[model samples]
Structure formats: C-alpha cells, structure tokens
Target chain A: MGRTLTEKVLGRKAGKDVRAGEVVSVSPDYVLSHDNSAAIIKEFRKLGVGRVRAPEKIVIVLDHIVPAADEKYAQNHKSIREFVAEQGIPNFFDINAGVCHQVLPEQGFALPGLVIVGSDSHTPSYGALGAFAAGIGRTETACVWATGEIWLRVPETMRIDLGGRFRAGVFAKDLSLKLIGDRGAEMANYKAVEFAGPAAGELDIGSRLTLANMSAEMGAKNGYFAPDEKAFEWLEGRARRPFAAVASDPDASYESVLACDLDTLEPQVACPHTVDNVKPVAAVAGKPVHQVLIGTCTNGRLEDLEAAARILRGRKVHPSVRVLVVPASWQVYREALASGALAALVEAGCVILNSGCGPCLGAHEGLLAAGEVCVSTSNRNFRGRMGHRDSEIYLVSPATAAATAATGKLTDPREFS
Target chain B: MSRGAVWKYGDDVNTDVIFPGRYTYQIMAPEEMARHALEDLDPAFAKGVKPGDVVVAGKNFGCGSSREQAAACLKAAGVQAVVAKSFARIYFRNAINLGLAVLQSEEAAGALDTGDAVDLDLARGEIRSAKGTFRFLPLPASVLGIIEAGGLIEYTKKRLEREQE
Candidate 1:
C-alpha cells in the first residue's frame, strides 16, 4: 500500500504495513526525556517496566529545569540521572549538553526516515532532519520506556511551496511568522507540512530547522524538508548507520496547499498575545520596546547569533532596552564565544543567558514587567506568556530584534545596514 | 454513570491557561494544580467549579502548549465533558489520554454560556439543556473507544490485556 512519511516511518518501525487511522504498535528509533517530567521514573517503577524495553532507543537530556535551580529541580535531574545510570541508556546529555531538540540533530540522534518522540512539545523540531517526531505525555513516555513502541495515526500531508528569492534582511523567522499569520495557528493541526520549491531548497539546514521548529507553534504534527546533500554532510561525521533520503513523490497530492513568493515577502512580527496576530514590520515600526531577546531553540543557532552579532558589532544596546542572548545549546555557545559573537554581544551590553528555554517558557530568567514591550525571535507571543500577563511581546526575526535592541524601538535590519 | 454536570468556557481558552506554564515542572499533584485552572482568565474559577461540570468554549480551543496538565486539571476538576468548536491536536489527545471527555460542536460553543446546566450523552453526542437540544459532531469510533475505556492508557491496557487473552 502507498503511504506518507508518518505511515512509512511508523510501519517500518512496527515491522508491518501501518495504515492511516488504524491503531498499530510501532517501535520508535529514538525516545527522548527531559528534566521537566523525569519524575515519572516513579510512575515507571509502579508500572513494573523492567529496565526499559530497549535502552539503546532511549535519548534522555536535562533541559527543562537546568542547572538545578533548587532542591526540587535538583531532584528532578537526579531521578533521571539515576534511571539512565541504572538502565544504561545509550544517549544521555547533561545540562551542559544542551536543549534536547538542538543537540539531538546536532549529535546525529535524529535522521531522515526515523521516528522520534520526546516528552516536550518542541520535539517536532527534529522534523527538519526529515524525521517524524512528536510530543507525548508522561504516561505515554513510561509506556515507551516499557516497550520502545507507540501507536500512531498517520496524519494527512499539507504542502507549502515557496518559489522566489527573499528580500534583503528577511530571514526564515520572518517567513514563518508570515505563514502563521496568514493561515492562523490551527490551520494545519495534526498534519505534516512539507516545504518545497526554490526558496526552501536555497535555505541552509540551520534556517530550515528554524522553520520546522516553529511548526508546533502553528499546531502542526511535524514540518519537514526532504533530505539534501547538506543533510548528508551533517550526518557524515556523526551517524554510523545508513539513512534513506525521503521526499514526496513529484506528483504527491496534498490535503491543502499554500504558496508564497519570497521576493515579495517582508520582515514580519507577531503582535502581543498570539503568535498568529502577525503584521508586517512596517506596520509596527518605531513602536517602543522595553526588551529584545535573540535566542531559543528556534533561532539560537550559530547563524542567529552571527546575525545578531553583526548588527550589534559596533553599537551598544539602548540604555532603556534590555537585550538577552541565549544560544540554543552549549555547543553553539562555545562556538559563538570562540568566534567573538559572544564578546560582541557582551560589549553591546547584552545579557548572555544559559543554553536553556529561559524566557521562552517564562520559567527562569527574562520575564517581562507589566506593560513592558519585548521584541524576540522566540516562537509564541501568547498573552502574559513571557511573564507579566499584562506585558506585551512582539515576535520578529533575529536581525530585526538585534536592530531593535540597539535602537530601543521596533526597527528593521535593512534600515541600519 | 450519568454524564455529570457541565461547565462552559469561551473559545480559544489555550492549554497554557488550562494549566499554566509555572506548574508543568510539578505534575505529580495534578489535583492540587486544578485549583488554579483558568485562574488567569477567571480568578474565581477554582471556587466556582464543581465536580461533573462541562466546559464549552469557542473555536481553536486548547491552542498552545502540549502540557498534559491542561487535561489533568480538567480531570481533577471533575469536568465530565468539554464541548468546543475545535481543539488543538495535542490537547485533544492529552484530554482523551487522561480520561477527560471532550466533544466538538460549533453550535454548542456559540449557544452555551457559563452557569447553564447541561447534560451530555457521550454515545449520542447530544447536549440537553433547558434552552434546547444541540447536536455535536459524532466522535470517531477510536476516540469514542478511548473515552469509554477511560483514556489512552486504560485503552492501551485493555487492548494489551485482551490481546494476551
């Protein structure tokens, strides 16, 4: 029977021909755990799962409660650390290792034509590498721990094609914001979004990852770009096994189709309260900004840091505007620090934050005060999402955010350079 | 058991508010967390809610976050059914996984109001209120089976047990 990526991955994992809308037991090539719910070790203990069904499939990382803020957070990490030690899980990254999504593909745990599941929503970020990844609950994670398999319903595919070259200073972040604004967040719920056409092919793997990572913000099951030579180059040094190059057949049908020309695109921003409340940057130009953040698993890659560093290289952040920079992972951090990006940001008076979610989830640092305005490259601008319920968040590309940080007002990157 | 009392909510009542971001790190005491359900939107929600009530909301409900705490809070609050115009995919699965009953009805989301007494029939996908009877889009057999068996875990357990037999 013919199948889509979701069905193909699930079927191969299950050792059977999995069908859409049918429940089938399928093993996952990779399973991920984070500190937020590692406490489920107790639940696994009660479930009587003996030593995890497949230890090699387990990929655990310490992310959510990083650096162990307190005794409780410390215990959360301790629980997972003990479980990983006892079970002999093959892939375990401590807090220094970085956010699971960033480091997973970085170290080559995620590959094309595989199935991966994490205990966090952004697990879909791995879709950029052409894998099927989704977030599941703790009990489901426990079940996966018991049996490296899960049941899945193959989702219909949605095709979004872009064919033109982007305008100056327009980044993938702006393109994604344009998408979410045009279609609304739930437009592609429970569906796969495949990117194609000239513009997508021209984008580097890092930018593609930024686009795929935020698919969750729009409620997509996963977003994928077919495996390219660059992907092979990325895997050459890391992975041991052969990977299949997966893409839709030339004539593949889509449940829906959306097309945009990159040449006509503009730098966009998501207005306060909703990721979907999007508008072109020109509409909100000159708006006051209290803060600007240039990071998150979404845009915290080396390219993102380089973009911000380039804009802030010879300038200081406005005294009234606080700017925070967080690399997606420690690897990115060390690379930036070595390449002078970190020093440039520090010299510009930007707060260099740790490589965790921070401010993105409002759990750790960088919460906005009442009525304060922030321009960030992070996904999701939901109300009070960054901290104060009344505080407003503006979502922009990394370049725009850096430029805005230096100016203390919403400004486009093109205007400065 | 009779379908319990129904509580109503407006549309787009995202997963973040159902279970705030601050509490995701501590998910063991889901019931205690329920005390703050919708507290961001309605400060008195925890006090106003009673067991077996239903929550009805507008379109694109459960829009953000995949935290199971959202469903866990609804389950802890003893919410019997959630009828909305639509649900975000992960939240839908999480609610079903946690044994919380959720239904979809564009009309029900439009007509229902807070404090209105509602009786929901899971099998029929019908909502009966003093104002009138409203029909909902029927649940697929799979989702119906999940709800009947008390959620995904229980459903999976039942399947596993039956397969063994």
Candidate 2:
C-alpha cells in the first residue's frame, strides 16, 4: 500500500508499520480538552494518573458553558481548573480564552507534521495549518491525558481534487456541502481526506480550514492540507521552534479520488436532518426562513464575516427574519471590527453573538422554536440540531444565508450584487 | 451463562439523550449517570434497564456527543452489548474503550424487538435473541483488542506488564 498523509504521520510517530484496524500507540504533539470535556479530568482521577505525562503537550480551553451558564457547569470548570493547577499544565485557556481550536492555532500550539487531538468533533478545524487533528472520545481523551498518546488505525485516504475557480457568489461552504451531498455521509468514514487541486491552491488558509473542519460531519477521522507557504505565513508570528514538514510523496496512492470543478458549482444547501442532503441554491431559492446565522468554526473567520458584510452593506434585514453573526474567536472578532465588517452587519440589524459557540450548540442564545426555519452556515442540522426538535434548519453558505436574511426568503447572494 | 437482568430499547437511539449536556460536567459515578440514561427519549429508561440486557437499535446508534459518559452510563446500567445497524465514530470508540460491546448488523437491528432475550458472541460478532440469530459486523481489530482487555486502562497495564516480562 502506498503511504497516505495520515499513514506517514502515524507511521513516523509510531516508528512502526501502521496499518488499518491495528492497535498501535503514537505520541501526539498536542491533546486538547475543553470545559464540556473537562469531566475527563475528573475521570482521570479515577484512573490514578499521578502527573500528566507532559503539561506542555496538553491544552485546556473553556468554551462551552463558559462564564458558567449554570451551577453545574461552573462546578465543571472549577474541577478542570483544579486539575490544571495540580498537574501544572502550562497552556490553559479559560472562559476568557476564546474557542480552543481558534486560540491553539493563534498561539502557535499547532504546527505542521504534528498530530493534534481534541475532545470536540470540530477539533478537526485546525487542519488548515497542515497538522493532523482528530476528535476522539472522552475515554480516549483520558488515555491521552495520562500517557500523552493514544491508539489509531491508519485510515484509508480519499483524495478530493479541487479545480477551476469559484464563482462570485460561491464560497468554501458551498463546496463542502456539495462534497457531502455527492458522497453520502458514510463515504469518508474512518478515512483521511486530502484536498488538492488548482482551486484548492487558490484558497486562503481560512478557506482550507473551512473545508477540513466539516470532514468530521462526513465521518472522517482526519483531514489535512499539505504544508505550503500559506502554512508558513500562518505560523510566522506564533512560533520559535523550527519544525520538519510532512507531505505525501509524489506517487502516493489513494483508495479513491474525487474531482470538484469550482467553475461549474453553485451555492448549495444541506436540507433538514442531514448534512448529506445537498441541493443547489437554485433548487431552494424561494424557501422562506425564520433565522439566518453566519458562523461556526467552519465559516466564522473574518473573511466569512467580510463576505456577509459585503452582501449586507446598505441593506436592512427583512422584518420576518432574524440574523445572527458569530465570529469564531475573539481575534476574528477584533479583525472584523477593525475592518468595518462589524459596523455593516450591525447597521443591517444583524445580532452579533460572542466569540464562542453560542447558538451553535443549541445553548442559551438564538435558539429556534418549533416549526421555525433557519438558514445557517454552521455544520449539522439534524433533528433538534439547532434548538427545538421540531424546527427545520437549512445549512447554506454564508453568502446565501446573509442574502436570505436580508430578503426574509432563501434568496441568492447574486441577486443582491 | 448470561450474568444479569435484561434492559432493552429501540433503534436509532442517540448519545445526547443517553447522557444529556446537562450532566456532561458532572462526574457523578457511572451509576448516577445510569439513572439518567435515555431520560430524554424515554423517562422510564433508568427504571426498566437491568444488567446484561442488550439494546437493539436501528441504524446510526450513539450518534452525538464525544462524551464517554454515554458509554459510561450504559456500562453502569449493565448493558452487555449494543446491537445496531450502525454507530457514529466517537461512540463506537468510547464504547470499546469503556468495555461496552457495540455490535453492528442490519439484520440484527431489524429482527430484535425491544424486550427480546439475546445472547452475545463477541468473537463471532453475532447476537442470538428470541427473534433469531443475527450476525454483527466485527469491530475494528484495535477496538476488539481494547474490549477484550477490559477497556483502555487495563489494556495499558497489561501492555506494560508484557513489556516488563
């Protein structure tokens, strides 16, 4: 079998023959835990792990239920705080630290040629920086917590080749939705998804991150981009240690390869209850919506906000629709505000949520009631995915969502410009 | 011989309702969690579930939340194996790591009713219930190893012992 990006990383880390379905252990460059998953720390106590193998190798971020939405949640953070203090884990991001994946890359914790694991599914969001990031369960999180390593099966790799350039109204979110639709959710199950092609090369790092972040929704184990100049530029300000690069060899073979031509694609949406229910914007053009949200770890970068702002400029939101804009992190929020994107969105009557997963997790804010409809840029819109179990959610590109919010109907962004 | 009482459930049961977000922060013993397992979808889940019963669900069982609490609760509730058509990625890993058996089979999921008595063959990946015998797709070899070793910690200890030996 030819080496895949996932195999190369796991093999080097394991220093052995890594194969699918084999029980092999490999050290990770970083292990991430969050407030919702800090309960693992409490479980770690039961396992009798003395000191964490390496505090520097671990990252703790408090995002979910941050600032303590309830007493139960506050106590959860308190326990994580206690564990971090006891273990002397040096890299700790608290309620004020912003989203974990966002801050990890921002602070130089993620680097190329390293394996990163987090407690959340969206942890794969960091693959844009050319690292292997996989989301594991809490027990696996605990195993990593105690030993700084965990077992993995070297997954078969599937190559997605992007060609041509995106049209004016299309964005990375549309492309991702299109992939999910063409290939069912199970197509990428337990596989490494490598994205390559001329269109992929033209995309910025943030756009690549958007593509890789949702690979989890397709049931992929790892998603990555090859290290390029963009990766170096992303690492410029936050690193001091020199790192070796890892990439697939020229003749690396893939189990399957899919080619996506951007020039032929249009804005797309994933219908209710399934991310794989993909359709073009023209198919759902006149669908009415009750809410429009434009953010998630996938599309919550400053560029996404800028795109939404560009569409919303000089226009007011429809009376029937509520628009919510959430920046993925505090830094992204600062960039948006500095660039006047925030002003445009606010003037257009869009509600700006804090820099965490506010309405994304069906938490305290922006929840939908029964029978209501929402066009959101977030990943996943399953039953009760957004808020109420009965509400319908239409997953769309940020441009489509913004334009729909402005028009109170599922209008195309091209309609405005 | 089967070791305990039977507790049963239907198909397509998800991980979120098994262990809701509200309890994710609480490290209450698995026993405490068992009391709340499936509370959202079925209020009587805690009361009716007994040790050694198999949960037969349709496709995509254990579909949400990376929290192992859902598995911990099932184990604490003493579910011997989860026989389903399919499983979400995180839940399958969590179940094996927690020493809970998850057997996948479309036939097994289709044949078993909520309260049927069943026998599990871990090695063969088959479930024998009153409805009939259904073959479960084998788990990944790594996961099967962990399950046989009685979860992650024990497997680690055994590996260290062998290394020293």
Candidate 3:
C-alpha cells in the first residue's frame, strides 16, 4: 500500500493518487531543450502557433555544436535567437552556458519533488537532486512547450540499493558500469530506478549526478535518489522554490530489489559496441589506447576533472595517446581554471576544450579515425559512436582514463598513485 | 491491414548507428535525414527502402540517446512500423510522438528474418508473416490518439485551438 517516489511525485503533479501502468496527465515544473531547440522551434512553427503557450516553463540551452560548426549550424542558432527574442523567453542560456541538464540544476531550474522533461536523454541527471526528470523527443518537448503539460504511464520502479562503502579507486562511474553490466541495458526499460541505501547517501552531488546521468544508458525512464541534507546543501540558495522533500515508503512497490555492494566492486569499463558490454579494467589491461577523453555530461563535473588532473599532474601523456578534457558547463570550466585543474591538465598534454559536449556525441571534435581505440569517460561505447565503425571506444572512469592517457594503455589509476 | 518486406536488425540496435553522431552537427530536415537512415548499420538501408516497408529487429530496438531524429529518419524513410522483442523507453515514446508505429512481440521478432514478407494489421494488433501470425499489445488509447492526430505537432495544434476557445 506504500508508494514509490515515482508514484508520490507523479501523483502530486497529477492532482490525484496514481498507480503504475495508468496513464495520467500533469503539468511539469519546467521543460528544457538545448541546441535541439532549433529543431523543436521548427516543429513548433509547423503547428501554426504564434507564441509559446508557457514560455516561463521552458528553458532553452545552446551548448551542442557551439560557435556553429558551419553555416547550417549557425543558421540554426540564428533562428533560435530570433524565436527567443520574439517570445521574450527568459532562462535562455547561450553557447557559453553548459549542457542543458547541467545548466538547469546549476541555475536552479531543477528542484526536489518537481517533474522536468528535456529533449536530451541525460535529463535524468537532475534526478540526483530528487527531481523526476526524463528525456523526451523534440516533438513531445514541443508539446510540453505548447501546453506545459504532458502525459505519462507511471512506470514501474526498480529499486537499487547501493550499500557498503567504496574501496579506494572505486567510484560512482565504476558502480554505474557495474550495474549496467549486471542488469543489462533493457532490464529496466519503461521503469524508473530509485537508488537508496548508505552508499547512495554518501555520494557527493557530482557522483550522484554521474549515477543519474548513466541511467539513460540503462534504459531507465528516470533515476531517483532521495533528497537528503546533501542535496539540500547543494541546492541551498539555488533551488527555485521551497520544496517539501519526498521519498518512497519503506514498503513501496518495486519490480525488484537489487543490492549493489561497492566493497567488492572494481573499476569497470564498457567495451566496444554496447554500454552493457562491461568488463573489469584488468580484463582489458594492456590494450593499446590511442586517445583518452576525460570529460562529458556524465563525468565532466569538478570532481571528475580534479581527479583526472591529480592523476595527470607532473606526468607527461604517452606520446602516442591524445588526451582531451572538456568541462560540462561554463561554471565548471571557470572553476576548474580558477582552481588550477585546467593548468595541470594542460601541462600534462591534454587538449582542454570549451564547455560543450565535444567528442561524446562524435560531432567532429575529438573524432576517432578507423582502427583507433579511445578510452573515454563518456557514457556510450556503441560502434561508430566516436566516428568510424572500425574505430573503438572503451568507457572508463576519469581516473582510469587519465592513467590510460599517461601510459597509452588501459592501466588502473590506483597503480599510478 | 498492410503488407511489407522486413529489414531485420539485431538486438540493442542503438540510435547511434541508425543516425550517426557525425551527422548530429548538420541541421537537416527529416527528409534529408532519411537519405542516410541506418546507413551505418545497413549501408544499403536508405537507397533500398521503399514506402510502406517495415523494420523488424531483435530486442531493444532503438536504444541509447534521446534523439528523436532516429524515429524521424525511419518515418521519413517510409518505414510504416517497427516490430521488435522490446524497446528502450525513450525510443518507444519518440516513435509514437513522431507518428511511427512500434510494437513489441517476442514471437514476431524471433520468427521473422530479413526480407521476409509480413502482413500487419495494426488496428487489430496482429502481424502475419511466413513463419506465423503473432499478436502484440495494442498501443494505449492515448498513444493511439496522438498517432491518429498525425503526431504531437497536430495534437498540440488542436490543444492550442481549444485553449484559445
């Protein structure tokens, strides 16, 4: 009879008690779109609507392909600006901002007990703050922008309790890869995953964000971690409004319960062609790594960058390995620069990119040629994810990535220190 | 009811292959996207596609990333529907929102192979192929409503008119 966090939050938004498998309509707190806003705007125009129904509930971010890769991309950006100007929409973050998911929480658009939808899959990144967020298509986003309301069939809940403490060199990324590997990507399809237990609470907001961010790769509708004092501390003055904390009842409905023991887990990697194709770092050790990328929406936070910097400092990158570092947002980028993390990375022969989704999506920045192997901290390792189908990508933690760059092979980070 | 030849894909056929990340930078229209639909996975998909064709695949069709362009490209490639063992949550919703039909039927996915002829009765939630006839759960009424309205654009347009009224 108890309710899950997904049920509790969605029921409140729907103005009634809801259950799994029942379709309900509700107004979300905010809807987000990034560079894809250009595509969304085009679709909105096709609907023959003159203005956005609720501009305030919509936040637009221009991070992908910033500075416009070419005239086509530049034209897309131009139209987005025109749309924002005509609609007088606030909360429009230009190219200098960061990824949409990061910018939303950073600027206070993401708050506990709220429902947020975005045009990007990693929208669940906000769930670390106790908000219910998920990715929707551009057309669905257009609908949310038009009416501020969306419909959903409350997904079943998959409760994963991360218990025990993490050993040295083990991180949220390793745990995430472990979960995906163990459960497989589609095990939680059409389901919301709620993280609980001691280890989940002990994680910093950044690490929690990493877990929430990779929920997309696990095929989760969204990922939730109960908002406790740590989340409140992170949102101190940044939360848009005062929100009553919400949590699932102790006996809440769950499709299944999984206990992820961090004490026994080791550094993990998702090998070429599939995220769930996970392997322990030692299994793939000594494989040649031509490039090492240590930043992305999933792992481009201050903690991740700082970890990579600490490992790479006073050590030159392997001559054959190309290292690239990209901060998730302008704020993170500035903070990393101010704190000298960027300097350490640069001195170690890493190419520091602007605060944009660079090679993660394989949009020309840091692309891999045929037969090349890259050790990346980004989420996916699908074939052709980084460019040529023959090229390969190995997903790793930032520490392992930095260590790999230094040695030009899949080396564990703990060995370096 | 409709009949079409199927182009089969394996399990976990991700969005990256259906629409490569290399093209993410190019802001192209749906039709433009169709030109390269599944080019990375099949290489012959776009040029070989015909209107009313269907894509049959194993488990987890259209997994990875929230890009709606994957569904849009398939729709633009004249794919009438996609039948699979299962689907990633976002891809399933995106397909419905973009006016592309998708269904989950383990039997259909397991029996059908590339170039097989399929008789699909979408209204009745049945797929008849050379192997056999299999049934799938019909999409919920709400999703059917959006599909009948020709996707979210038209659905939202009607909603806007009612709001004004």
Candidate 4:
C-alpha cells in the first residue's frame, strides 16, 4: 500500500497517515490571493479578526488588472495594496510582478512537497514543480487568512501516463487539449492527477507548467509531475529554500490509469465556449479569425515565445489578423528580449505586450469585439472570456497561434513547419 | 426543512454562464452579482428564480474558473440549493463554503425536470422531486458541521471567539 505523491505530501502536513476519501485539516506552506485580494480582504474583515493568523506565509499578487482597467479596478487595486501594507504580508508582488503562478515560483515562495492553495483556479500551476497546489474561493481564503489552516478532502489519484516521443510542433498544449478532449469532465472531477511515464520527463519545465495549469479545465483538484533534474535546473538560482524532492511511489495506488501516446498526438485546439470542446487542427481548418493571442500563464513562458518566433520568423501577420504576444513574467519577457525572440516576433508584425495575464481573464488588453474570432493559447474559451460573449475563441498552441496569425485562419503548425 | 421546486439544466453549466466575467470588475456585492445570475444561459434566471428554489443539473455544474461569484450569485439569487449529478472540484467547495447546499445524486439529477415540485431533507441525505425519491451520500460530519454553522465565515468566527474565551 504505497502512498501516492498527494497522499504523502498531504499526510505529512496532516501529521498522520492519510488516504483518499478522508477530510483532514492541514496547514499549508504557502497561500496566495491575487487582485481578488480586494474581495478577500472584505470577507476577512467580516470574520471578526483584527489580524491575519499567518501573514508571513500568505502571498498577495496583483496581476488581474494592471494599471487598473477603469476606476472600479483601480479602486480594487488600491484596496488590495492597502490590505497588504496593513497586514504586513512579506510576500507581496505588485502590478509589475506578472502572473502569480509564475511570480510565486520565480520569487521562491512555491516549493516542492508543500501544500499550496490560491484564490484563483489556476493556482495548481505550481504543481509543475511537484507542489500539491489547488484553488479555493475568496471566502475560504478569508478563512485561511483568519485561521492559517484549511480542511481539504484528500482526492483520489488519477495517473495519466504519457509515453512515446512527440512529433515536432506538437507541444504539451496539444497533449493537454487531447487529454481533456478524450476524457474531460468525469475522469478528473474531485481527483488529483499525477502525470507519469517517459513523456512527462520529455517536457521541459515550461511545458510542464502548461500541462499543470490547464489541469483546471479537466476539473482536477491539482495536477503534478514529480520533481526531477529539469525542475532543479529551472529553480537553480531562483528558489531560496532547500526543498525535499518528492515523487510518487513506484507502485502507488490510483483510482484510474490513462495512457496517451505522444507520438500520435497532433496539434490540438479547443473550440469556442468550452475547454472540453477540443479538435485537431486539420479537423476544423480554414475558419477565418479576427485575432490571434499568443500568451497567458498557460503558454507565456520564454520557450513558448521561442516556439512562436520559430514559426513567425520572416513571416508577416495577415493584414486582417491582429496578433498579440504577452510573456508570463518579467523574467521571461527580459529573457525573450535578450534572446532575440521578441525581435523576431516584432519583425513578424506581432505586438508584444507587457508581462501579465493579458486578455486571458478579460481584465484588459487585446479584447475581442462582437462576432470576432480569436485563436489563443490561453486556458479557457468560455463565452466572453476575452471581451464579447458573442466573440468566438479557439484554443491552440503558440506554434498554431503563430501559424494562424500568418494565414488569418485556423492553420496547422505543420503546414508552416 | 420544506417542500421545494426545481430549475433544471443540462451538463457542464460553466461558471462563465453562471456569473459572466464581464461583471467581475463592475460587481462586488453579492446582491449586485445576483442581478446577472445565469443571464447568458437564461436571461430570466435571476428574475424568475424564487426563494427556496432548488437547481438541478447534469454532470459538471459550476465547471469553470474559481470565481466564488458563481456560487455567490446563485445563493444571492435565492437558489435554496444545488443538486447535480456531479460538480467540478473547485465549485463544489465554493458552493459549500458559500453556504449553498449541494448534493450529488445521479438518480435525482437525471430524474428532475424544469418546474418540477421537489422536497429535500439534507440532514438525512434524502430527496423527493416530481421524478422520484432518491438518496445522496451525506457529506462528512466535519463538513456538515461547517454547513450547519452557516458556512466557513460563521464557523471561523465561532472558533476565533472561543479561542479568545
């Protein structure tokens, strides 16, 4: 009866041997709240508490609405800034910081073998480095603010084994969309997914970040890939703490096991209105689009920019198409600029925005108009996720997004390759 | 505690439709969010829903962002509870923490229809709608304690006060 990675991490925090199907109160190593900190602060005040239980352990980031979209958002940011200053939360990343997922790790707050929770759903993005991260609501976060602890039901583990080699231009985004397309709503509900097998090792930390971040779309509580050399390599100079590397047992029990052969997977896309409404690029090709967005927490890393630049080099964006490239973090943006990736993109007529969650949550920047069609690399494509509920969104990899921007339609990356 | 009625929906009712992201910036209060509850999915849901009305849906209700507004809007819109075949993990926690009753019963979820009369006994994990009588698994005792305490806020407030005492 070996313990799964989730069981071991949670059980260690709970100070007892635990398993799936049990609810236990566990103190988290790190808790995060973003621009929603404004709303969370409102609830925290109502909890009748004068001070936070563990202010030092909490992180507050401002990436949702930078420079404040309007007066209301500006006020929200102002409120959060005041809360952070008043509460004396040491780990505070303001507007210029970038997305909390990237910032948390870059700033060395997220660590392996820790239980991390955030107010936003994609907080599981930290699991790319083997942390047990999940999302909670603002009110629940308020409770954590007051008490410094939360009770979470240990979720059953779902093992997704990725094997075989990936074809060129078929990155982790394609594999993630295919997995959700084949088994979305039911398989991952209330379950934590452990991505195993050789293919999991094949992906770099950036690709792993994309896979873990979109695990939210599968209804997963969290998704994990065990810490390995790649994880250490990425965290080399950034991580401040010496973490105990954790991995699942060789014979750990799982609720279900799914297999995906990377060799056969193709460039994928999630159609408008649903994360699970996925399709292969060839299946729905030739649909004209008005815009192409090439960044977000999911695919806004330096490697993602490099991949897009590879496809966009010496090619101009279609006259009818609008392409926007946003890096995930300031670090990534700086590196992309230093590495000439930004130059290639700029030469290709792509507009490079600041490093933030641009146009993903529809907070601001690159918003779509009514009836416009957008090919994006963000996580969700729900109605009005960008700007107009009537606008259409197609989820694709950066390679495909760059290819589509060149053609002004849903073009396959292999065609450009 | 009382007999109720249902408003049915099909599978995968996402949070975007439940509480659109467009309102994330504009609306802050629960009542303000309630005004647009399910507006895209059904324009009249906010106005049509009455207090003590139960929402029944198929698989994966509240399946989108970690927006508490999805559950808060429904709670403010007078949805007594939500009974679905299943729920997204994050949404399930949000709904419960917001003090909105949520039950998972495949039999009850598939059986109910729009405008169907229903009755519930949350303590006993029992449901009686126009479709039939069905049973759902009761939440853990600890979870029930939070719900009984009127959600996380009330529960935490009690703990804080008792610790002070």
Candidate 2 chain A, run of 10 with poorest lDDT:
A16-25
Worst ten in a row by lDDT for model 3 chain A: A42-51
Model 3 residue A243 lDDT score: 88
Per-model chain A TM: 0.96, 0.96, 0.98, 0.98
Across A1-417, the per-residue lDDT of candidate 2 in tens digits comes to 466667777788899756554556789998988875566765566565577778888888887666677777777888888888988888888877576767787888777888889888777777777788888877778778777778777778888889999889998898899998997775677788888877777788888888888887777878888878878987998864576778887678788899989999888999977788899988888888999988877778889999999989899999999999988788899999999999999999999977776676676568789899989988877666566667888988888988898889998788876
By TM-score, is 2 or 4 better? 4
lDDT of 2: 0.79
User: Which CAPRI category fits model 1?
Assistant: medium
Tens-place lDDT per residue, model 4, A138-239, is 999999989989999899999999999889889999999999998865569888999989889978888888999988888889999999888888888888
Quote the chain B TM-score of every prediction. Answer: 0.89, 0.88, 0.96, 0.94
* lDDT tens digits by residue: candidate 4, B109-132: 988888898888887789986567
TM-score (all chains, Cα) for each model: 0.95, 0.91, 0.98, 0.98
lDDT of 4 at A148: 86
- What is the per-residue lDDT of model 3 for residues A93-160, given as tens digits with 9 covering 90 to 100? 88888777778888888888999988888898899999999888888888777777899889899988
Model 1 CA deviation exceeding 4 Å by range: A1-3, A14-23, B1-8, B143-145, B155-165
Off by over 4 Å in 2: A17-22, B1-51, B58-60, B76-78, B113-116, B139-141, B154-165
Give the per-residue lDDT of model 2 (tens digit) for B49-162.
888877777666776557788788888987887777778777888888888887888887776676667778776666776667777677666566787788987776566456
TM-score of chain A of 2: 0.96
Error of 3 at A366 (Å): 1.5
Colliding residue pairs in candidate 4: none
CA deviation > 4 Å runs, candidate 3? none
